[model samples]
Target: MPIPMNAEPNDGCEGAVKGAGENIVAVSPAALSPDDEVALRRAIGELRRESLAMRLTALIGRQIGFIGLMVPEPIAETINKTAESALRSAMGIALASLGDRSTRDRRGLHKSVATMAGAAGGAFGLAGLPIELPFTTTVMLRSIADIAKSEGEDLSDPDVALACLEVFALGSSGAANPIERGGALEAGYFALRSLLAKSVSQAARHLLDRGLSNQASPLLVRFIAQVSARFGVVVSQKLAAQSVPLIGAASGAAINYAFVDHFQTLARGHFTMRRLERIYGIVMVRAEFERLARQI
Candidate 1:
């Protein structure tokens, strides 16, 4: 089916993606050029690759088991703490001085850095995560920022940086369809965005107005907490996979490549959606996004 030109959710366009309990924003569809429609279709494909959990499973060829059995259960707690701290530190120092915002994204360089970090972590098995995870996360944040700029995001804008952090949260889920098997919209892309919208806005506002002097302010803290919760899920999975017998530096490097590649895919899709939203308004673009998602 060809993509819809007019996706009016409230006006009863077919397959309009309404959040389970959220209010739909009322906005008219803009006249999207043919190029814009094609771009929207491609973005939907990338978003559908939301299943990082499955991707890791496929790449490693091993089923990740329960936390306690794979490694010490305390590692789970450590993973969450590490995720939060890494996000905090990355926000403070990662891309602020990237320099030359107009240049093309250096995707290969970022992947190489992540692979090296992963090898270092993999060498010590689970023992290395506390040290390696944060460093690798910071590198992934830089890559995400690079993709955001490639998609035309202004890196100086606090909201865009917050969106960069959002990739971790979004990449943790594995849902392909917005409407799940039992019709729950609990973990879909649009649903997740709806959930995070308030904290994201508040955090962005606080950063824009007061700067990052006090990173522990209520709004920013809440945003980091929320993102860290989801990010911990993926980290846990990666840890479990790493717990597999004989996972040396080589396997670790491969897994890390897949890890960074997964987020890069999500980042590309997300920022592409944002770019289209800037042009056609989110409501129309989102409605059309769901329409295409259903068709696939």
Candidate 2:
């Protein structure tokens, strides 16, 4: 059953794909259960509505309180270095305790984000980067782990756990298309999904068997470094937002709040599309998704 190009998008409907004269769905011949189909459709709907430019605009946009403040070069470098170190530490801890994290509610995670942000923002550099950096990084790592759980990916397995690491790397991907209008945003989303989707499992296996750094495949370690760089970009922007004279802890906390919140949304959307891809075939979903993207 070839779906006509003119057919209206029902959003909630699980349409079929033509195959061998049999009415086969894209990923299976049998129809998906109502609940599963609904989940799939909802995920697809989100992908269609997600705007690359809008997300980028929000990421790079100045914080309301410190719009015109300029970040000094040394201060910027400190921000990036601290963030990179934090992320490196975070990855080590996550790997070591991969299977040991106890069940946690999102409420706990939310509180953690606020607490770290509050502490980091309260006196920030006044208290030394050592104190502030760990607090913020640990909080972020835990939040990212929670996001992995929500996505139905198990963190116990090295393969699955590495995927969570990739999410942080993908966080600051808004630079590609800063324009609010045009198809660039949609194209950017697809490009991002493509980059992160392949080689995750393979890379994870290599990392686990090789143990931490030095002996680990140079290529795999490099990939992890690249991900850290993405996070570094975010940290740089955040320091800029919080660096203004008299900006205070409240403003810094606000910036931290936005940072974690943005990544959580990213995980949800990415996993949703992944589920849909498993069910409907990536080619089909991408084609239809791109079509919807063009319309939007």
Candidate 3:
């Protein structure tokens, strides 16, 4: 069942979560029921996988050497620049077109569209990247919006639209080892949100205040740039994978399938976290997320 977006907090639990056999720990009042805890645990497990980089590495690295080595300096630059531009357009135009339409999401439809685009791009190889990436990125954004809506987000809210955009950044962050960067809180899902929180808020404010006419405004650019920085890493990996010798349209389609699928997985986890955050406050959800990550 779809989780309710605006669930009311139940009375019983207050200020602390019950642990093993009556052991209690201080936490936010947004305590989960037994069932909700199970769902939260499953979502946290998915979030912790860090699968995109590893999946790409395994799939592509086996055929070619390390995925990173396949790309030349020029192509890498092109990938990064293309990613930035495509994301900017997605935020301005792609997501702007999305609205809360039906109860069920059209994930399959969006993925098929992206796959075909990838096939077309793959036929031309790297030369087709500039055109291919933007279209596919826009499709991905649409799929993400569908996921967000399924998770009970109000797409009419500029903040939620930006949150859909944030999924791109989240996918890249998951590929990295959050623990390696110092502290758990310093790097994982929460940290990434914290980092983008300012830009997202500012950009959302700009959209609300001025609309899409000033998409080039400094506030929006900063937000897009921040998202693009992390997003570019995955895009580079994708380019390197597609660069392997004789990777024709069919292979390109396969890679593109994975590409959209990766973000879709992250979107589900991300929006699920957001859904839980709405139910239980962020503090409680985050604390539980950390605890569950350790247990898992």
TM-score, per-candidate, Cα-based: 0.84, 0.68, 0.83
Better-scoring candidate (lDDT), 1 or 2:
1
Decreasing TM-score order of the candidates: 1, 3, 2
Residue pairs of candidate 2 with colliding backbone atoms: none
Candidate 2 stretches with Cα past 4 Å from truth are: 1-77, 100-104, 107-118, 126-130, 175-187, 196-202, 211-217, 294-296
Tell me the tens digit of each residue's lDDT in model 1 across 164-239.
Answer: 8998898766554443434434667877888888787678668768878889899999999999988877777777
lDDT of candidate 2 over 243-278, digit per residue (tens): 546655655555566666656555566565555544
What global local distance difference test value does model 2 have? 0.53
What is residue 79's positional error in candidate 3, in angstroms?
A: 1.3
| Model 1 residue 166 distance off true place after TM-score fit, in angstroms | 0.6
Root-mean-square deviation per candidate: 6.1, 8.2, 7.0
Q: Looking at model 1, report the run of 10 residues with the lowest lDDT sum.
A: 1-10
Residue 234 error for model 3, in Å? Answer: 0.8
- Candidate no. 3 TM-score: 0.83
Model 1 pairs whose backbones collide: none
Better of 2 and 3 by TM-score: 3
